[model samples]
Target: MQDVKADVYVPGHGPILKGASALDRHIKFYKDLRNIIKDAINDNIEATKISVPDTFGEPDEGRKNMTVETWLKFYG
Candidate 1:
């Protein structure tokens, strides 16, 4: 969406985001997640240990987060 310079985004869930703040937050979430995965991989950590909720020590409040198992399925 950012590549296209979208002015608004309507996600599958929730209301339409009308500005950049929401988009920024969305991007930050993915960036953080990717960093966590990268760091774990670099440290030679096992894929089964990489879990979103476990890494954060709490459940995600609203978003549907992915598991490391899913990441391995795609990027392994």
Candidate 2:
């Protein structure tokens, strides 16, 4: 992070962030993803249920949201 004067950087799992704030972003991402998937499944959006899950991994409520197994079930 000290390599340059960059104010914000996007980590692997979170949005563009500065230091510790990235952790929170990642958590929110998972929670939101979980809700999105659950909504899609309930709505019977068959296409999205397959494709979105592929791109977005598993749904994690509090860090255990998404898993590889979850993704494989649809878009694997």
Candidate 3:
């Protein structure tokens, strides 16, 4: 994404994101999420018990729980 320069990004869901900073924020969000999940796994936290932090910027309760469940299936 950093290699591809664009004025705007059209995601499959959500509103259109504008500017390169949007990409940066997107990348950071994923990185932070990955780190959080990895840390949870290391701490022996149960997937069903894990909670998404507010800093993740994901507001949808269903989506947040689904994301953690999906990642747990893959990385837990």
- Using Cα atoms with residue i matched to residue i, what is each candidate's TM-score against the true structure? 0.54, 0.41, 0.76
RMSD of model 3, in Å? 2.3
**Clash count, predicted structure 1:** 0
What tens digits encode model 2's per-residue C-alpha lDDT throughout 1-76?
4354555776665556765555455656556656665665666655333323333464454433334237435532
Q: Root-mean-square deviation of each candidate, in angstroms?
A: 4.8, 10.2, 2.3
Best by lDDT: 3
Q: After best superposition, candidate 1 residue 25: deviation in angstroms?
A: 0.6
How badly does each model clash, as a count of residue pairs? 0, 5, 0
List candidate 3 segments past 4 Å from native: 11-15, 53-58
Q: After superposition, which runs of candidate 1 have C-alpha atoms over 4 Å from their true positions?
A: 3-7, 11-18, 51-66
A best-first ranking of the candidates according to their TM-score comes to: 3, 1, 2
lDDT of 3 by residue, 1-76 (tens): 6787899988777667798988777777778778889989999898767776665364687887898988877877
Candidate with the greatest TM-score versus the true structure = 3
**Model 1 over residues 34-66: C-alpha lDDT tens digits?**
777777777878865665533335555333244
Q: After superposition, how far is residue 53 of candidate 3 from its true place, in Å?
A: 4.6
lDDT value, residue 41 of candidate 2: 64
